[model samples]
Target: MSAGVVTRLSTLDRFLPVWILAAMLLGLGAGHVIPGLGAAIDAVQVDGISLPIALGLLIMMYPVLAKVRYDRLDTVTRDRRLLLPSLLLNWVIGPALMFALAWLLLPDLPAYRTGLIIVGLARCIAMVIIWNDLACGDREAAAVLVAVNSVFQVIAFGALGWFYLSVLPGWLGLPQADLAVSGWAIARSVLIFLGIPLLAGYLSRRLGERARGRDWYEARFLPRVGPLALYGLLFTIVVLFALQGAQITGRPLDVARIALPLLAYFALMWTGSFALGRGLGLSYERTTTLAFTAAGNNFELAIAVAIATFGVTSAQALAGVVGPLIEVPALVALVYAALGARRLFSPHVSGSDRVRQA
Candidate 1:
């Protein structure tokens, strides 16, 4: 709220929660007021994903990825302290925690519970990048962690889905659900969502630096394009909510029921991950990266899998739809939380501090 902080953030960055809330409300209003809005938006699909949503994600992600110091990626990969903890938190602790929360919170609502578990299994490969960047997390470190997650996502997602939705539930004497997901579909989603923006960002960084030098690219080009990331995010939120606004409004109680576990999951995962990172003696940037990556989920993939396996009208799919509705606002608040928590890591200057000092 200080002028110093206000000056440090772009108008879009400063009022991010406001913009996101308006976008969500706009999408919901438009969806409710305008007939066939969902159909119109849903008409154009890229392998079952809405084209507009896909474009928003690509735009949201590219600039942040472009800002990564790719040359320093080797150093990030070599840091076992960061890499190993990230892997464990994302793959092991994250899913397990979600599974427990979903079952514990939604015991009677099996379909929603299954959907939340599917959400849990899908570790973040996309929006976490934007959140990480917004929170002033390490760019190189985030890029590496994201890439690692994408690989694990392609390899482990279905297996984990089975383990959680079917295996583990069965072991516990709970009613089990089957997740009939295609490996190729999962692979394709990862390729399209992560692969495309990653390629664009890499090329943009590489060529921009080569042509204009690192100083020009970082100082001049990045700021110009950086705001686009948030623009894309807002657009995506509007479209995402619009696509399901009618259902969301009609089933307010159901949406609230599904939202409870998700709220708990994000809060717990982010706080725990941040604490773990600090306990491991990581810097603020890497710590933020670890926390965001661990806390975020691939909702796009979760929705697609849920729709593909269960009908779009199914409770499972509705649970997937509720994901970003809760996530966008919750994580935006956490961005501020991460910023405030930076003071706890004092004597350890943050990316925002470096920019302010510069």
Candidate 2:
């Protein structure tokens, strides 16, 4: 049953890049072919946020949250040797690095900057499994990292993302950011976007297991719904690009502009994290896991949160779409790099040991 789940996830991850691009094209096409359709979608607003976008964001986040078995959180603490470094790399250093890079790279484009910040704040949610597995990293450590990150993405991603938007600029004495008009603005946005899915996902996991049994929940039910986030992603992408078609048409170069910082972010984070782990003389298995985890981002949640906070047509939303465009191929390349570099680890840490450790 577990094998089946992993296989399905692997297949889905492999094809996700194609679907994201398709969604981008579809969105752009829909806007051009049917301007009225884009207008209609643009007209959708409820309390400053689009209803369809809110629903799509909910769909994108709920499955991710529901799939996490928070019950295993105890084990994460037990592996703090591995877990602690991952936490700092993912939450502390990763976000800071992306923020600095985004500011330095995209000085004039605040929306795109905010989007990159969102991506930075959100650590890998699901796809890191494929990344870690491909790199032959430690699966046990991956599980611990995933469990911890799942909880943190909910509790911390919003606050820290807001910090990047609202507080960091002031602290760094950088130009005032276009982000978060006020603290309450981001607080409200977080409640609607991240809060709802978090509650629903936790309750669904607990209640579904109680009603149907754990095996059914993980093996049968989760596999069924896990792909809904992607569906939501595609739908949201279609609507967003459709709505912003005119803007995108005028500024076709903006896509590439947004993508560059993200590409830089992935390369920078992977190398830095890998070096940090190796510098500590950590096992290759654990170091590889950290490298992948630190490099990956939960763009699903980031996209949802961006659209929720900014408008569907905002540059922030555009930044969200650009993330997957770069992350998929970049991480794939990193997988090869990790595999090729395996021999450089301590002689005591063999490939066979990684398999057993994972």
Candidate 3:
């Protein structure tokens, strides 16, 4: 990318999340004032799916899959430290912490607590890649980590979801038997939101590489798709928040409660992954990449599954929506923090090297 292009991308990276939040606020206001606007927007559906939301998620995931450097997967096996830490943090530690926090902090609200668990159990399948890249993570390592997380999410999400809802909640005091009933619906939503977009992106990249050359694929296509994905994600956020505007307005404090555990989860996971990366003697870029890839949650899948499993109006679904609102801003701060920390600790590494390492 050219200097101007890189600069523009960086600006979008910083602002996209804010823009998403703005769109959500605007949509919420519009939905409230216009009376029927929320229902009208809700009516925009295709094959029992919400078109605007589905389109947003579809485009949002494109950039993530676009960045997957499948060519580098061979090299990933050699970096076992980075790979292992990423897997453990994302799959094991992150989910466990989220489940624990949900039980401990979330009040007796059934839907809200379930939603938090859903968000926690579903590892990030889309925007984690963007955060990882923005943090100046190792691109090759990031690509591999994203792919690995995607696979694990597909295979393990249902089992983990069951554990969090059916088993963990009972251990506390709020046991719910209906948790198992949502599995099939959750699975289908995951397939639609994650599986379809991933396959389409991968196939398109493969075809584009063969027909249009790597330069065209990377320079011409990737840049165009990146912002589109962010816009789509924002649009989805708008619809989601608009639908839940009343609930959000009434339960403002709930957002803070949900955010606290998530913030703690993010800090703990990022720190643990970063420390593990440094202990492994990996380069700064690789360490940063692992830290973020492990820390981020796949809100797209979580939100979709939440809506499907629990009604869109359910508190559980609302909690899933709240996740990104907190995560986006927090992650932006973490990116800056990562950069500064990297510079402070590894002062010998030049700015150019830092960028390259990312």
* Top lDDT model: 1
Could you tell which candidate, 1 or 3, scores higher by lDDT?
A: 1
Q: Residues 1-358, candidate 1: write the lDDT tens digits.
A: 3355546766678888899999999999999999999999999896687899999999999988888888778888888989999999999999999999998999999999999999998999889998887778898898899999999999999899889988888899989899999999989988888999999999998999899999999888988888889899989999999999999999999999999999999999999999999999998889999999999999999999999999889999999999999999999999888877877775655343335212
Total backbone collisions, model 1: 0
lDDT at position 256, candidate 2: 82
lDDT by residue for model 2 (1-358), tens: 1343224335555455577678878887888888598779857877666677778767876776676566754554686667788888888999999998889889988778888888888788556755676566765566567667877765776578668887889888875544433344444555666668767888998999999999899778877886786677667667767766666666669978887888888999899989888888778877888899899987756766777678766788878867765776688778767766777876564321323111
Go through the candidates in order and give each one's C-alpha lDDT: 0.90, 0.73, 0.72
What is the Cα-based lDDT of residue 112 in candidate 2?
A: 86
Q: Could you report the Cα RMSD, in angstroms, for every candidate shown?
A: 1.8, 6.5, 4.3
Q: Can you tell me which runs of candidate 1 are displaced by over 4 Å? A: 1-7, 349-358
Q: Rank the candidates by lDDT, best first.
A: 1, 2, 3
RMSD of 2: 6.5
Q: Look at candidate 1 and give me any clashing residue pairs.
A: none
Clashing residue pairs in candidate 3 (N, C-alpha, C atoms within 3 angstroms): 111-316, 124-297, 124-298, 136-358
| Clash counts for all predictions | 0, 1, 4
Worst 10 residues of 3 by lDDT: 349-358
What TM-score does candidate 2 reach? 0.65
